[model samples]
Target: MAKILVVDDAKFMRMTLKNILTNGEHDVIGEASNGKEAVELYKELAPDLVTMDITMPEMNGMDALNEIVASSDDARVIMCSAMGQQKMVVEAIEQGAKDFIVKPFDEARVLEAVARVLR
Candidate 1:
């Protein structure tokens, strides 16, 4: 199972992702409420993957993805956002996000992204 870090400002969203990852047989090594925490946790945990929400307090997922990718060229991150954030999704891919998942999340899609990124 891949070690994953889940980053989202909303506690409920974090929990939902944690459940999904666990059910998919992945290990959730950490959860962060914002990009700042996500960056720090990523440095410490060195998880195999990260699921990052696009909008958050302190810093956004785009910035966090940049930071992580800057530090580790091979870092695998999947950007997550609600519907209608297509522009940001495209930007995220350009910034090095392995994939993007639109919320409310689908079980199959989330797992698919996770599996694909792990591979």
Candidate 2:
């Protein structure tokens, strides 16, 4: 099982991600309300992976992914996006995100992405 961090501005979204990750047998080590908080938590927790929302207050997923990967070359981040944000998702992948799960995420897809990244 991998240790993970869930980062999203919406409390419900964070809860959803938490449920999914936990059900997948991963330990959610921390939660963050924004990208800035995610970066700090990343430093503190060093989770095996992070599920980061693309749009958030203070900072966005791209910036957060950049920050985390910069600090740890092996940091794994998966961008969570809305339907129309495919371009942003691509940018995130190019920026070092391991994968992405579009919002209102599918449980299987979330698990698949997490598994792929872990492998």
The number of the candidate with the highest lDDT is 1
lDDT of 2 by residue, 56-105 (tens): 99998889999999999899999999999999988999999999999998
lDDT of each structure? 0.96, 0.94
Model 2 weakest 10-residue run by lDDT: 60-69
- Name the lDDT of candidate 1: 0.96
Among these predictions, the greatest TM-score belongs to 1
User: Against the true structure, what is each candidate's TM-score?
Assistant: 0.99, 0.98
Off by over 4 Å in 1: none
1-119: candidate 1 lDDT, tens digit per residue: 99999999999999999999999999999999999999999999999999999999999999999999999978999999999999999999999999999899999999999999888
Model 1 error, position 96 (Å): 0.4
